[model samples]
Target: MSFFYSSIVKFEIEFFGHENIRSNHQKTIEITKESHLTPQGDCIVGVNATSSCADLPLELKNKLKNSNSKIKFTISVGDDEFILEGRGHPELILAHTKDIVIRKSDFICPRTLAIKCDKASDLLPRTMVSLLQNPKTKGTFTIDID
Candidate 1:
């Protein structure tokens, strides 16, 4: 007998919000079938609560060459947390500022998320937690692979 498992699979997720808030738990996202088929390509990912440039702290905001631009996050995937900056949008996290987190289902905006790592097959178009750094933090984004 033989068994096989494919990396591509549908996903359902639960996003845990701030510790004080429990009603915001169990959030979900819907994706199209097409977004799941692309293994080594880019797909649209809806990001919530992405701090605007104006929202950024004065110190972090001042370092940017363009104050008008939005701040980009260091999109890291998997346990190793490899960075996906090259494929990311023009906005950046910059050298300073490490305080960032995603939580709940705000559906801030759908941004493009590229899958171009050696472990691409292992993760793509699936449901997973992006940033739940600690017990106090419920995480920032809930990703769903179609």
Candidate 2:
């Protein structure tokens, strides 16, 4: 006989208005319910929005719309913001950038960030494992609010 084990985790990321935009830009952003498993073993996030009027350019918006993978943004322990791109499983490709931040009062546990993995081994090299393992780090992980 043969046996296999599979597990899945779901996360939510909230988009906050850009720095230059008003605190309440009043734009609408939508996320879809479709989920994917990344190669690294993380759930691929989904967003479904009919329209978004935020400051994001049309090209970027299109990119988000056409993206068939899980897209994530996070603030590293060093306070640098990064975007994690994955397809069909947790094959996380990290993109370093300066345009990410953590917002308070957005959820019950604002610091609870979600990490996706396709293989358990991929997490062995991450420092976030300890933080994510902590029971305190349990909040809805969102990518963008709008």
Worst 10 residues of 1 by lDDT: 16-25
Q: Write the per-residue lDDT of candidate 1 for residues 1-146, one digit (tens) a residue.
A: 99887432222222222212211112222112221222222222222234322344544333332323222233333342322211222244422221122212222223212211122212322322323212233222322221
What would the per-residue lDDT of candidate 2 be over residues 1-146, giving only the tens digit for each residue?
A: 99875322233433221112111211111122222212232211111212122423433334433325344433232232334332221221222121221212122121112223122212222343333333233213234311
Q: State the displacement of the C-alpha of residue 94, model 2, in Å, after optimal TM-score superposition.
A: 22
Give the TM-scores of the predictions, in the order they appear.
0.25, 0.24
Question: What is the number of backbone collisions in each predicted candidate, taken in the order shown?
Answer: 6, 32
Q: Per-residue lDDT for 45 in model 1?
A: 26
Candidate 1 residue runs with Cα over 4 Å from true position? 1-46, 66-73, 76-80, 85-146
